[model samples]
Target: MEDIMRGRFSRSMITVAVAAAAVSAVLSVSITRTLGQAPAARPARVGGKPNFSGIWQANNEANWDLQAHAALPAAVTQPGIYPYDYARVPAAPVLALGAAGAVPGSLGVVQGDGQIPYKPEALLIKKQNAEHWIDRDPELKCYLPGIPRAMYMPYPFQITQGTDKIHIAYEFSNTARTIHLDKVAGPPDDTWMGHSVGRWDGDTLVVDVLICATHNLLKLFRFGWSPQRA
Candidate 1:
């Protein structure tokens, strides 16, 4: 009778081991099948066009000067003494900030020859504005940076696409603009952020912008004049 009981116990232990192995094998197959499935797809285009919905920002010094420029000690500079005349020093307004006020260099973002095609008179005005930028730059006063200028300002902007409009929200001065993809009347008055009309050119979205004359304090640099395209 003792031998019979021992044999029954051994069979019970074997049954338990087989049950555990079967569960583990079932779990392994389930895990394998799950890992083999394809991942969920992300939307690459909207309404049969490329999607432009996302946060964007410029990573260059185009906001300083759209044309190619070498790094400078300061945005505001004056001639140094004697042999160092070519080596300009920072002007009083930015002198105290030292390296912190220095201008960073860039290869420029101009589409063509990397130079703004400013007329002779406009060129002179551009120089004057650069000299007095501390007082003249609208950005210094938390003013709305107009198109293309708003595009490259040292701030991030968000793009949201709609069925008939594309909206851009800029971090600078909390400015924003909308691109009309459908027909609409122009703004009754000129605006600081300007009126933007947009259309699809193949996969590219082309925008036509019109800014107000009052916001032209840096007109030479604004109005899509610098870097050709931002």
Candidate 2:
């Protein structure tokens, strides 16, 4: 009886050792395979700067108006009869579209006091442009939206960052601009997209822009002014 008990204990010890060895071998193989593979790639960077290479878009009513406003029945409206006697209606051009031509309300993107600090004279021109928006807005005419306007239009844009230059392409009118990080000659003539010179301010990118003559022309007809910087 003592010999049989000892034999049984020996067999149990051997079985436990074999199972442990099998598990150890499987883990060793897994670890070896993991270490042999290449490391995963990281996001692109230039000189320790963040990569801005991606498609981006703005989802807001900034394109409609930068100032806060209430929802309106239409983009254009005419006078209605005396106090509570009559309701306002859409103007001739957009009347056919009904609610489709209405302007949605926005909280406005302006930073301070929710008002654009327009010069008195410039403010008059702004009012006129608002009144004649349908006829004068450059977007309606499919013109290349310039500068900041291009940045916020309801469309997608792409940014490709490089060692010394960043390229931005806008879906609107296929417009594109290059932001130069290195010193370079300015454009011979003012361009629709303007000349953009850039520098990194810590992690932020500051850009200085000089607009084309066409932008000033548009200001008189459509947009207020060409942005000087972004």
Q: Write the per-residue lDDT of candidate 1 for residues 81-102, one digit (tens) a residue.
A: 7557449889999787788678
Clashing pairs in 2: none
Candidate 2 per-residue lDDT over residues 7-55, each given as its tens digit: 9999999999999999999999999999999975647777789889888
lDDT of 2 at 59: 93
Backbone clash tally for model 1? 0
Could you tell me every candidate's TM-score relative to the true structure? 0.73, 0.72
Q: How close is candidate 1 to the true structure, as a TM-score?
A: 0.73
The per-residue C-alpha lDDT of model 1 at residue 127 equals: 81
Total clashing pairs in model 2: 0
